[model samples]
Target: MIQRVIQFWRAINAHLSGSDFDFINIYLNKKEQNLFFAMRLYDQRHVLNVAYTARRLAQKDGGSINEKLLMKACLLHDVGRTAEDIFLFDKVFAVLLDKYLPKTAHKLAKYNNSRNRSFWKKRRHALFIYYHHAAIGAEKLQKIKLYDIAEIIKYHHAPPKYGDCRELIILRKADSLN
Candidate 1:
């Protein structure tokens, strides 16, 4: 509950600081930056926070993680959820719906576009993006030849299975916190 409040607060006030912009430029190349910037400002801010948290978590892992790859993975984790797919209200609605009524949320989370202007279609699209952003992001990364990073993003929201990589673990932890 408190985490949702924090997330809501952060979403409303999301913006990029100068240093955040610099950090993004340093870690992402031109193509990567395009993908990152394609998201809404709120998501950009969230990813920046996740990247910092991931680096801090990696530091405590005794140098076993690849910081660069972790940072890149964190920054581009939500590239699948672009500004076009969701808005501020839609994000809030998706979160609340998924939290209090997951069954309904699932019902609305299918990918369909036959009735693009229908009320249900709008809600469905938002929920779809909410639930499937990780896989969508992975496909985008793969298209850009970022297969290694794509694998990490693909399972960022998945439950732990055997033999998860150090980077994926760190990314997921950081993502959950922010």
Candidate 2:
């Protein structure tokens, strides 16, 4: 509960400094950077926090972790939530709906093809994106030939199972922390 409030406050005040861009540029190339920047500023800030937390978790784990790949995956984990698909209000609405009324949220998340841009469809689309952003992000990354990173992003939100990769575990932990 406290963590959620802290995250909300941080989101409202999210901003990136010049050095943050320098950090991002270190892990992402021009095309990847474009995708990263396409997200809203709050989402950009969230990914940066995820990347930083992921690196610290990797350092603590002290295994044969690919730090570069981990950093890249963390930075682009939320790349699916672009400005268009789910804006600020949609994201908040989806979060609250999922938290308070998960059954309803699940029903809405199931996508139905509709040509009209009605309010209900917008809510449904937001829930769908919220639930499946990882897979959506993976597809986008695949289009840009980021197969390895896409694989990590693809399962970032999946349930933990036996033989999960160290990078994926770290990314999930970091994401939850933020």
Candidate 3:
């Protein structure tokens, strides 16, 4: 699974870069390079689902967010999991709570409820790999001055309920399709 995911990531990166690593990819490599590499494995149809959904919702809602940006957020949302298991984020989250976050990051994990914990906690425990990663992803987008795109990242988890923009709606749909 790890190797297969790596191959998938390589294909997408090859498409995006058109040859090799870009300046941004290079910088990501320096920090969390594994996450950058892992992004290549994201399913493209799932990515397109986000764009298509965003387009559909945008017609009803308002403005359209960047399809590419939303897709990128969907693909990269779970990259943090690369640090934990390279295949799934839930195991990574558990490992983080047990060893890293409290000691290294000096933070304690807080969850919504037992049901939510059982739901999301078991899915991706060690990394910022789920809904919250949407917000985390939004922060990254904000750094690039794409706050609207960031909002898409922020709401991908909740969809129409919390998703305020067309792009976020798209992201949620794409994620759901996956």
Candidate 4:
């Protein structure tokens, strides 16, 4: 609960303070920039943290990893969370539903496809994305021809099958650290 509150406060602060995109300009291409900016400010800040952490981890790991791809994966890993403009209460509810009533949460999330829904309906949809953002982000990345990055994003929250993906492991660790 305390962690969640801290995360919420940090997200609100990040949204209010606007990120300095200049720092990451050299790392991302035009298309990537557009996608990154399309996300809500809270998510954008989170992505920046994740990317920075991933890069640092890579450098500390002896420079064997492709730092660029790792950073890209980190930047886009939570892109799916941008599917809706979620508020703090919605996020808390989503977490609770995901933890205790997962099936119901999934059902509610899948039910609303129209953007013209009521506030509560939209909240449900956002909750669904929160739980399944990894796969959704992977699909988005795949559409942009970033197959390797997409694979890492897809399995960031879960263990990969082959279990030998060093980049995925590093990304997961970095994500958790931030």
What would the TM-score be for candidate 1 when compared with the true structure? 0.95
- lDDT value, candidate 4, whole model: 0.77
Q: Is candidate 1 or candidate 2 better by TM-score?
A: 1
What are the clashing pairs of model 1? none
TM-score of 2: 0.93
User: Candidate 2, residues 73-174: lDDT per residue as tens digits?
Assistant: 999999988877777778888888889999989888856446576887877887898999899899999999999999999999899989888999999999
Top TM-score model: 1
Please report, in order, the local distance difference test score of every candidate based on alpha carbons: 0.91, 0.89, 0.46, 0.77
Q: Model 4: runs farther than 4 Å from truth? A: 15-19, 83-85, 160-164
Better of 2 and 4 by TM-score: 2
> Model 3, range 28-127, lDDT digits (tens) per residue?
3343334446442332223333444544565566564654555455544444233332233343344445454545322333333333455544343333
Best of the candidates, lDDT: 1
Residues 1-178 of candidate 1 have per-residue lDDT tens digits of: 8998888899999989999989998999999999999999999999999999999888888858888899999999999898988887888899899889999898878775554557767778979999999999999999999999999999999998999999999999999989
Name the candidate, 3 or 4, with the larger lDDT value.
4
For all candidates, what are the clash counts? Answer: 0, 0, 14, 0
TM-score of 4: 0.86
